[model samples]
Target: MRDRAEITIVGAGPAGLTCAIGLALAGKKVVVREWHGDVGHRFHDDLQGLENWTDPVDVLDELAAIGIAARFDHHGVSEGVVFDGQAKPHRVRGKRPLFYLLRRGNAIGSLDRALLDQAVKAGVEVRFNDRVTETAGDMILAAGPRRADIIAAGRVFDTDMEDGAWLAIGSELAPKGYAYLLTHNGRGTVASCMFSGFRDQASHVAATLAFFERHAGLRMQNPRPFGGFGNIRLPRTAMQGECPVVGEHAGFQDALAGFGLRYAVRSGRLAAESLINSTSYTDAWRRALQPGLRTGVVNRFLFNAAGQSGLDWLIERLARNEAGDTLAQAYRPSLPKRVLFPLAHHRFRAPLIDPSCNHENCDCVWCEHGDHSAAIAGA
Candidate 1:
């Protein structure tokens, strides 16, 4: 497979698959190696949002512009409820759809599954359970987060409740992040996304479940727990020697929230285009994505400083205006944020020093748990 592929991608996640599809369609032989048995193996039919409010263009339209079609199932959500610290509900209405709800992981209708099929159809040679330790020639590292800056722990289950999106934001509920419940077609997902206090995630998840159960009339039939972590930071570079690191491998994640799908997909396309054009992937991503990602870091800093009072006030303000407009501004780089960028960078610096990474599960990195001598393979 190594000798066959003109481009060897180390991960079969969205970034790697997207890169493979683009390259193969351009008549370049592309092969993707996934240590996992299948794509989206980390998630288990978990419901996650493909947020659209941050960018002016709708996510699907934006993906189309980049040549990635929306072949997967999606549920558009135009409005939702946000509950502040004191159990106060704020109705949030977007001018268009706020975000699209889709399943993640290796499931039948998941984004990962869709991308895998698209890559295969595009003539990408995908090798599953292949832990590529070493390879020759061009490679793109798309292995996801290797460290846990933020952790989300929760459950998915069958429910009798109607379709809806509900979120709870408070320091006591979910530390610096938020707790959310997304339900559609009798399936429900409840999760607590916490920015800190990883050890206390259980209590926070329980608190979020209780809050939603009381306020939203939530009901779970057969619940199954699922947990994962995220790493968000503005890296100094996007290159690992000649190999371009896309997705979470490049530390391309949102600071304010844990949304990385858009970044992942966009970076993948940029990497492919750069390789095809024999240009610089670093310049491409910097021009296209750095501003928003920097804004996300600043936004996270502000959120950290605001605490409960600030969060409550934010809810009140979002209640008055269209959520899409306000959220877009929040994500965009402003003068004030530009001025505060240095301080924000100083505060939430994610050097991502993870010594406890047990690579027993997936071949994300060549990390032999505590060792890194054979930094030879990654996906």
Candidate 2:
């Protein structure tokens, strides 16, 4: 089915749908093409959450400020237990909600489904199972993550838990990333995100299960296994031949933790604003999000390099403060302290040195201007 509109968005995820809604409300005809049957089809019973410390305001409030009135409950998470593979369970508690949890599925209440509803209400036309390779008119590529920087093995199960979250860090469970168990309303999702140890993934998953069982006292039945990939590289250019990429495809993910829903929503709205106001998408995103994202990449590199011992050291350092305030400050996006001067002092270290990367993924040296390679390589 061939059609034309003022704007054509690919992949009906948070970013694409948000863009559609914004453009539609502005009286522009918008069409969205989805490869899957419905919204949130890419995920199963995965329990995802958005970070709150980075932004000055709450994530839900930020969404509301952008006129996104999705009717979904944001489960506030105020406290959690962290384990550094050995130390007695370190309990971190905050005065306010540290994050908000949501399910990832096509259910009526899922975040993706909620966004779709809002988009439709704004007169955005959505075509399901209409995988598109090429398109005409102003284009927005809101496709999900591009490459697998960290592969996650997840499981959804019926558990007798009383609603809580637990994060564990150790070489045996997850190499560079962390393993988390989130339970709510008698259901739970447990996953091991691996950064370097891809070959021993199964073993890592098994070890995570065992560790949680012993430490968290997790009781479950009928555990179903699933997996997905996460990409955390920044894009060199926001435009691909006049098309702007949004969501995780633009590397708008948090480097310290894999929280990106806020970034997805923010980028989508920014993309739509650019299209309507005849502004530069790249400049807009750079002004709003580039600093935080670049800081995240540096944090990711340092965390990976530190390995298990370094991770333990960092956590212990955070534990020095009783109220978990230091930890929050460490994770929050601070341009002057965390990024600029730190990078200048340390010579701007990164995980990848080469400027050339697959253009589709956009996590290249050219995109971030990381080092020497970007001088010759163009994105």
lDDT string for model 2 (1-379, tens) is 1234568898899888888988898888999988778988657757887777776687788888777874875588978888885846887776667888887778877888889889998998999988766645678887776655666776889987889999998778877678999998888889887765555667888888988999999787889986766667667786777788888767677766777888898899999899888888899999988877777766765676676777777766655654346655665566554545455324333432222334344432222222222111111
Q: Local error of candidate 1 at 345, Å?
A: 0.5
**Best TM-score goes to which candidate?**
1
Q: How many clashes show up per model? A: 2, 1
Pairs with steric clashes in candidate 2: 236-367
Q: Report model 1's TM-score to 2 decimal places.
A: 0.91
The residue pairs in collision within model 1 are: 10-379, 143-379
- Expressed as tens digits, the lDDT of each residue in 227-321 for candidate 1 is 77776777766887788888887778898889988899989999999888888888999999999999998988888888788889998899789
User: How far in Å is the alpha carbon of 153 misplaced in model 2?
Assistant: 0.9
Give the poorly placed runs of model 1, Cα more than 4 Å off. 1-5, 350-379
RMSD to truth, every model: 4.0, 6.5
**Collision count of model 2:** 1
